[model samples]
Target: MSHDVDVLALENQVCFALAVASRSVIALYRPVLDPLGLTHPQYLVMLALWQQEPRSVKDLGAALQLEPATLSPLLKRLEASGLVDRRRSAADERRLDVTLTDAGRNLRSTAESIPQTMIEQLGMPIPELQALQSALTAIIAAATRTSELTGEASDE
Candidate 1:
């Protein structure tokens, strides 16, 4: 049988494409982020914090689409690196808040070029990249809705 006609062909699978693309694109950031002393996940956390300061752990989790268990270690590592500070929220002692240290704030300047760098690396024009991003976002929303409808827990 031709591979094109095989329903189970790995190359025909959307998940396979997405998984490979995710890994490949993240790999591109590895070298750039190394000098900043950040792993991909930690970089995501910093992005959220850089957008807004003193966000609660819950808020950060929501923004990053990560569960607390997964996010905790990242926060701990960022704190250890002196890039972030985590403290109990004064308004609500039970809640934890995260804020960037000056170092984390300064890192944003260096990171500002990353988007353009990745675009050049991918050799994709701005409009095409934007369209791809839009499509992927729609896919994510649809997948999340399907999971919710089926009462299935989303890995996202």
Candidate 2:
């Protein structure tokens, strides 16, 4: 407790709280999503695809905040699971497009109940959970925007 300590001390770190909370939430999701044959990262990829049916690998990586190196392996796993298909873009032979297969599309039926399961698991009221989700969504959006802006600046 030195008075000369830096202002950026661990006790005042929102990042630390965010990281701990995120890990805890993901842990809660593990048992629920496990039966669906999805890891947290894989579920995130599915969420993106569900929102937008087909997207290029580059686009998916950008949306998921992953680099191709990290994303490729995950995509491979999903492809092997028969949940997604990665094919060469006919319009651009150099590019790859990832599309959810029929099984992947059908997974939404099973997954739709996950939100309720999570609420029951957390024992939180829907309103409270919605508030938390909103706050986290905003934080993620701001962080993504910041990263994108910084990336663009660095590339110039």
Candidate 3:
């Protein structure tokens, strides 16, 4: 018994589900990240940098799938928080690079526990969490593919 309702239409809205899940997950991370003095975006940058030091800004932006303008302010905030440093390339004056500081490296010890804590909080088994991550990665890849295809058509 439906009164002008389209449940299937609502159920098909992947964007809505994605937005809800992303917001909920980020919210769960806020308190856990607070002590480390990092926001979700900042934490993401640190993850990238933790794997490699002294990445060029352009390369970092590309690796993170972020535009420079969006990443710049986040990097500035990380710099202000003493977690990251931005400097010009010694040989290439035109290029700016980012390096994690000692404080940033130190913070990793604290952050190391975050994933376990979040898993406990999420109450999901490790296998289930891994499956969820794999699913999300595929969804992201498909979304990116669709965007790239549309962008190429538009450009042509």
- C-alpha root-mean-square deviation, each candidate: 2.1, 3.8, 3.9
- Order the candidates by TM-score, highest first — what do you get? 1, 3, 2
Candidates in order, TM-scores: namely 0.94, 0.82, 0.88
Q: Write the per-residue lDDT of candidate 3 for residues 1-156, one digit (tens) a residue.
A: 376767668565877887788899999999999988899999999999998989999999878888888899999999999999999999899999999999999999889999999999999899999998999889878877888977742112
Mind giving the per-residue lDDT tens digits that candidate 2 earns over 51-120? 9968999999888878888899999999999999999999999999999999999999999999888888
lDDT per residue for candidate 1 within 1-156, as digits (tens), equals 675598788988999999999999999999989999999999999999989999999999999889999999999999999999999998999999999999989999999998898999999989999999999999989988999999986784
Best by TM-score: 1
lDDT of prediction 1? 0.93
Screening candidate 2 with a backbone cut-off below 3 angstroms (N, C-alpha, C), the clashing residue pairs are none
Local accuracy by lDDT, each model: 0.93, 0.90, 0.89
Model 1 residue 101 CA deviation (Å) reads 0.7
- Candidate 2 lDDT trough over 10 residues, lowest sum: 147-156
lDDT of candidate 1 at residue 155, scale 0 to 100: 88
